[model samples]
Target: MELEALHQVQGVQGSSYPIYLGEGLLDDALPNMIVERGYTNIAIATNETLEPLYGKPLVKRLREYDSYMIVLPDDEKYSGLNTVHIIFNQLLLRNADRSTVIVALGGRVIIELVSFVGATYMYGVDVINCPTTPLAMVDTSIGGKGAIDLPQGRNLIGTFKDPIAVFADLQSLETLPVSEMRNGLAGIVKTALVGDPDLIDMLTPDDQSRLAYRPERLRTIIERAMAVKVPIVEADHTGLGERLHLNLGYTFAFALEKATGYKLPHGEALAVGLVAAVRLSHRMGLCDAALVQRTEQVLQSLNPSNAPVSYAIPQGRAIDVWEAMRHDPKWRQGKARFVLLQGPGQPIIHDDVPQELVLEVIESLADGVYPRPRSWRMVL
Candidate 1:
């Protein structure tokens, strides 16, 4: 049964790879990927957490080729320089060379690890991103921003190497924790807020004034978000130009993640970041207060606290996440750059964002200065 729901994203950016989005695509996508890429030898880079679930199936499918599976420890905390070294060691031991295709078969952590290795390995090798999580599919796995976390900051060591292909199997999302699913939505929200007015409309309901998460609805949202991202990446494959627009939502997202010591998932921090951007936009007179409030309403509806797991992150953690942002290399010159919304589909990268304003917006959310929708209002 071929799932016709898949959306094919033609590479407007770096290498002109294809993004396959749909259910039950793995069966067809994996083998075709190997043959199409001319990868006679392949390595599946995964983590202990995901190896048990999909690794064997993938291995069996690609068994005809000289394939090896590399599994790393499966926790976000373990994603670091040491992890990168382990991947390199395995690749070297396997005699993986330029012809070897590194298949990142897990979430953001695994993708970052493999992509980093691919970028630096023998001056670069082929990388195929097989993102299993919604977070990976909608955000991390799409763009070529690869990095591992450091004690001082998250993604401190990384590179901009676009993947040869990104195969996002939505069926894999079934295995993801609810927290991770919600976290992935944060990226979609950021994509919308930065640009993609159509996505913003889809995310915000007219009658309810809140965000809604229907599977079909989300698929379209993810597609729209990718549309916004692909063009920017195409214009500046190395992130030297319009690509900075994508980072507008990311700056706050990364800072919040670091501030919380990564206790918060990437998507949760992104939700906070989107709200921060909206508030910042309002303060800068780029957008209206109503727009900010409406945006908050949509986000509050999708907050992870409303999920079955109800991840209770502390206010102190959120503050710490903000503090960590201060040390980010991008902010090294004592000034932070932010992507603030000028209007729907209009995102302006501002290098002059006041530190005070950024701090105030984070504090407001942490302190409940702004009213959170009842659905998301909870004492952490």
Candidate 2:
């Protein structure tokens, strides 16, 4: 029921907006935000999977306004230049002018695509994010950073654009699959491991289903995770400093996703990447060995079945993955800058990581060695 506003920059009109987090708030809150923002026309950007769940209800509620829906492909692999073109064509078909507001409904993939469309359509338009998944509700929805995956790497193309408002309805998450919920926890774990140690406790549950069974506890976890991101975004909107810490496990995660041809969902791959990152940090003497063990244990607690896939990457093919990291968006100058942890809540950026060590970790990850969790037995 409480509305929080991000800090506004001078001369920036749409940089600051309200974020609402609660259950069953969609019918009243989203419409009121649109009317107050003075948008007479609206376009809902979503995907096939989520259109029936969140998008249709929104359409019913917003019948007072001129509105149409652009349903995109639900797969994350489809988050590319082609998808953006489809959205643009829809905007044109619906005759959505600059005055129109874009309502982004669904998980992170849909949110990212909608944010990009709102950012590039006729220069810019208002975006209202209604995140149905935990990842979007906690991390992606709050930040204005919108990106699409390229053949080279994930989120290679992106823009910094804030939404006019963000509506996170916890009720919407009830319809989500359990696998998708586990995937979202990867981002929450990344947030906690880097900034808020209390969030680490939230994810320490041994049973993954408990998180879904306890909605109040789940809400607490989300709020705690967002507390870590909201301020960092407020301080460094363009990711010049502080915000770079959020790259925590993304370097290896993106590489893994690219290697698997993106069959792995973003969050699951991120969990694997977090394990590799901690091991790398320990090998680099940045973090103690205990930190590495604890981080892996926490991750395994969430998804005990996560393990390295031998078939996902060929033997000695980590070199290929290392090459993929070079093309990551986080690469600076000619080197890849990685967010390494010194300890819980202590993250440092390191770009001078030795090539041999990088290859060792990547190779081990491929061989199911370095990131081997306690439950590892090579299922595949």
Candidate 3:
């Protein structure tokens, strides 16, 4: 993974933060990077899935720093107020203060949980994130939209607080199962279409499975995906403007998650949503049908994790998905705001997608499924 690069996420009033992209930075460079910055204490927070595999070893490596560990619940269902209270209790007990830098050392859920924790902890402490998963490294870790799920829906309670820095260590991906890799690819594929359309050329049909284990190509993909997000973030810190383009297929993605009672993994669900978005574009005459055909071809190639779940959202529940779309944070005024593709790189933000057409597009995504590659283990 030689695609090491330094990206600056511009902040308000001309301020900015650095995102260090490389392999082995988490357990190698991160400790000294924190200490050298004059931070006196550190709070490394991760989920149960990552604590033993990555977090504990990292804490031992950084034993010299005034740092303690906080292990969060692994399941998304636990990412609510109760989880927040638990984190607060742990921080209070360990004397985590304003000087303490909360290093979010896991995938999106834990990263966002700890981000919100860092944002509100002692009226906001600095957060330096380590995104272990692919989806997180490129998407969640960049934008400061630290969010937590509420019983009513996902990401209901959130804050727009950027991390002091982001360290995306490619080495951490070695332990992840194929499904986890595909989860990140969903975001990567989206980034290519929305930001750098040329990146899609790399995901040739035969290269999709190999890209997961192939270090050089995978690193380049992650780096390019991150590159696509930075400029939009700098321009719109709050997700009211072009940043919404980042949510290309999330309208249907979030709805499926809600419709399924949040059982479907986000990335897998998003693959299906991307298909829905492109199909909607064709149905509305915004783009040619070839675009939808090409989308399915690409998403199908990135199998197992991202091969749009073999789901035909039961019409009874499809209506539930439609309702979920209405309450979606991205929903504009009284209509659904869909970021549909006019072509590969040309995304159009349409805020007036009618309810009937949205359902038709959602239904058409269930044509067929391609058999996914063998997974070494279950997704975290």
Give the best candidate by TM-score.
3
Ranking by lDDT: 3, 2, 1
For model 1, residues 153-189, the per-residue Cα lDDT tens digits are 7788888777877887767766766556665666666
- Against the hidden reference, what TM-scores do the models get? 0.84, 0.90, 0.92
- Which wins on lDDT, candidate 2 or candidate 3? 3
lDDT of 2 by residue, 1-380 (tens): 53454333221344467777888767787877777777777888888888887788888887888877888887787789998998898888888888989899888888888888888989998888899888898888877888887888888888989887788888987777655676677788898998897678767764535543567887888878778888888878878799899988899988887877777667667887888898899989888999887887777666545543332367778887788788876778887678899999999988868888888787666544324233321100
Which lDDT tens digits does candidate 3 get at residues 178-212?
65777787788888889888787676445334543
Task: List the candidate 2 regions with Cα displacement exceeding 4 Å.
Answer: 1-15, 206-212, 304-312, 366-380
RMSD in Å for candidate 1, one decimal? 4.8
Task: Name the best candidate (by lDDT).
Answer: 3
Which residue segments of model 1 deviate by more than 4 Å? 1-14, 36-38, 204-215, 304-323, 368-380
| Model 3 steric clash pairs | none
